[model samples]
Target: MSSKRVVFDFDIAFTNGGGIQGQDFRLDIDGDTITDKELADYIVNDMQLLMVRKVDIINKHYITEAHKRKPVNLKADEKLVDLSHTIFDGLVTYKGLPAPIICDYLSREQSKVNYEEGTEFQIGKITMVTNTGTYIDCPFHRFEHGKDLSEVALEQFADLDAVTINAKDAIEIGKEYFVGKELRNKAVLVFTNWAKHWNTELYFENHPYLTGEAAQYLKECQVKLVGIDSHNIDDTRGKSRPVHTTLLGAEILITEHLCNLDKLPENGYKFNAVPPKFKGAGTFPVRAYASLG
Candidate 1:
């Protein structure tokens, strides 16, 4: 009998639009030790789950180190690529509401003076809610008993082993969809095809969502994190948020309003969606991104 072996792929592809779809993993065991026929029988008989393990190794490796070394260089005279955008303005506010106001200014103060003879200075403050744009809802957003945004450990938000589930057209995501899958101790990202309605009213109604049973199953499995590229993780029309309640109640962080998830591989790139460490705050906008290293 030959020894058993497993093959892991790190360069998984995350699509460019919204839905999450990519290679999560492909397990390979020695044919002599386990026998191809025996392995197939085990899967048919529901015993293969015991033979695979998906480990989180983000802390032990640099996520963007590969990109840093081999930067994306354009022509020396080429125009730069504009990567930043303000998606949330007066047009579309949180919960389809109004935006915040800005006030206060220090016009006369100056720190250093490359002072022109007729110079003026101004300082100001802006008052906006945390859910101004694409944001993350930590466990504290739902439960007072859970850890607040500041109290959440950094490891929970950054350098996470990410898995993207393709649920774009799925009306309901249930436990059956994830049963027997290695979901424990990893970031479980859901890519619903709802982002297509980003600026339209359709994005707010009848959107796809994870079932309450699925949330409970994830919590029981101890998923490290949960994210969805949708307006809200819960059904907007429903009063009870069983999905959010179950996952957050178990102290799992939730990230909402993610874009470019389609660009991520199902199980390869390192996911990092970090919010500010603000005390007493449960939710905040984040520069959520993935590192394909």
Candidate 2:
């Protein structure tokens, strides 16, 4: 198959300044063979640019040399720890919520007819509630008219200065744990070690959780996000979810069922728990992790 060609212009910008300045550039891509979105992603990934804000097509003819850029290398001492549980077929994340029904929407064997020899693909699908696995909660999770998952800003969920408060063996975490700590614009993760019982019958029982006063204190400190490695941020046995109500009411994001907190230091790391941009959804699972510099 021959590759189609197209010329385009783009305005690139970096999240941090002093990088490359925004400029219009032309490029030739296989417009007939590749989708517009794939071509745009190629420009960003190949150029090593932070974000592609705009793309305008100029022409759809003539081929040119594909621009190449080197990929960023990780530092020698940098560490990344996964803090989320893997979602598997028929695996229970929460007690009452139905387990995710993982299956192939399009089987690999069936796709052989659509592609050339030896080419196959599998398209999988999952059906589950938003609260399954390690999930994040926005204001809409608690309040009727509040910021949903799509409404929350990316900065609120990613690349935030993080600190973990180890409260192992404590069932109720109180405000005293964070009395004098600096928490403004930071991801405050509470390490309770309760995640050790994950995927077991004991995980749904009485587990460690943050108290109402602790949530209130975090709200007062303007914390960007709050997370805990436990069943729920609030005591699930009771009807009043004060911890969720207090924090979400103040627009503070929350992440639950996180693991691997023991691998992270008390400070000097960045935390991220970003979910998909699903409009009208208040809660969703995230691939929570921490980057240690």
Candidate 3:
């Protein structure tokens, strides 16, 4: 039996600068009349995409409809919410109690004579393990010769195209799950319903993980990065972290412990999870987010 599909349509108006609509920028759903049925038909016949039934134009209004025919560049009132959870002291400390003592204080001595009426301070330091909070593991994290955080290019971790694959119903995300899917040169994010355990002890246990075969498939496809809303990308029950091994060995990065993944629509938002630019650090936390307009 085929899975049931549904399509929800809503009209959106976008302008640049303030309220001026640009003629050069057009959102053409297969050169159709921008209706739901035609857009859905285009996805089915032209792209061979599935799970989308139809697209319909729910409403339309000219800029003049609101502001008396004034041409100003304005964007549709869209909000960008952060998807990454905050990093606190001992928030996501490893199970073995190697948690770092995260504190906020001045590293350098404060000015002694400058306490009259001015503000004088020193730089602060946040000491912690490389694998704290929502972090990404580059190739060098698992292998000695693999690319380290410095070795990995900015494009690999930043905004290179991204797509999210929902695996909510599957028992495991294996190679077969990725078959017939285009993954080459894309950031593949796995939504496994694991973000619910962000700060709970259960997050450190045997959570949903990507299988080795899935890793191999992504490797073959030359995926730029792989992210999961789970504790780790590998099966926590096993000693061998095969998923991390396979993907990282192929120079693919791994982002773990993501949150708010459900807010993003599959295959729409651009994924970006960037770590700090540091030398010799194999892993570090990031502010992972998605941009939608």
Candidate 4:
């Protein structure tokens, strides 16, 4: 419904030094009116410009046009939806675990000496636990003798039929939710909308989780994978984690901290959440997504 767009010129000065300018840029606004503050924030965030000190919006005007950047053309049989959170520096996935320390090992400016004129590259380094972002658990996570990341078959985590169980406003999801659903060999993603509280203190307190019975039911159904859009798949209150034990013990993969499940339909889709094949590792982050027709 937002057909309004703004065409404007802007100059942004960085806090450190140097500045950049743009002209004749068209941005779709949420409504017919937009202030300079919102436009400046949008430009800085949309461009991912670091160290922005000030933004000057100039020659601004509105126009009625379709948003160019939002529309895409895809075949009727192909549509992909992202279901993972972006991992960034200082993002706390869990309370006790240290946030990821991401920094550039070889920066673009430093690479100039080794390259021909004007050729630059950046090599980044990340130091964090495997369970930093939206991650999957292998059987090895709970059992020492179970398969590790490198040993699990690709069919276990990639391109599998999937379903979404809606547990809106429910704190403890039970087995009743899955009694009539076709869950066998399907990646069942539970939508509790808990991701809306991510990056906040509330996200870690009394979050939605699957009860032990739910885990047993999914295991009995021989589900390929179980994903949740919450702080965790199982309750984090006590020292016990029956859900993880029940599911991963049966070789059913578990993907936690998944987002965007509300955008998916009930069924008739393929889910993919493949982690890097790391030897001796039990868990690692994944770029989870759903392919729908």
> Using lDDT as the measure, which candidate wins?
4
Error (Å) of candidate 4 at residue 208 is 0.6
Q: List residue ranges in candidate 4 displaced over 4 A.
A: 1-78
Best by TM-score: 4
Q: How many Å off is the CA of 106 in candidate 1?
A: 6.1
Question: What are the per-model numbers of colliding residue pairs?
Answer: 12, 0, 10, 0
Q: Which is superior by lDDT, 2 or 3? A: 2
Clash total of candidate 3: 10
Ranking by lDDT: 4, 2, 3, 1
lDDT of 4 by residue, 1-293 (tens): 44878899999998899999999988866657778887898778778889899999999999888787753112222489999899999999999999999999999999999999888899999999989889999999999999999999988889999999999878999999899999998999999999999889999999999999999999999998999999988889898999999999999999999999999999999999999999999999999999986
Alpha-carbon lDDT, every model: 0.66, 0.83, 0.69, 0.91
Model 4 lDDT at residue 95: 95
Q: After superposition, how far is residue 76 of candidate 1 from its true place, in Å?
A: 16
TM-score of each: 0.65, 0.74, 0.69, 0.75
- In the range 123-201, model 2's lDDT, one tens digit per residue, is 9989999988999999998898999999999999999999999898799999999988888989999999998999999
C-alpha lDDT (0 to 100) for residue 214 of candidate 2: 91
RMSD of each: 18.0, 11.3, 13.1, 10.8
How does model 3 fare in lDDT?
0.69
RMSD in angstroms between candidate 3 and the native structure over all alpha carbons = 13.1
Candidate 1 per-residue C-alpha lDDT over 191-224 given as tens digits, one digit per residue, 9 for 90 to 100: 8777777767887777778889999999999998
Residue 65 in model 3: shift from native, Å? Answer: 17
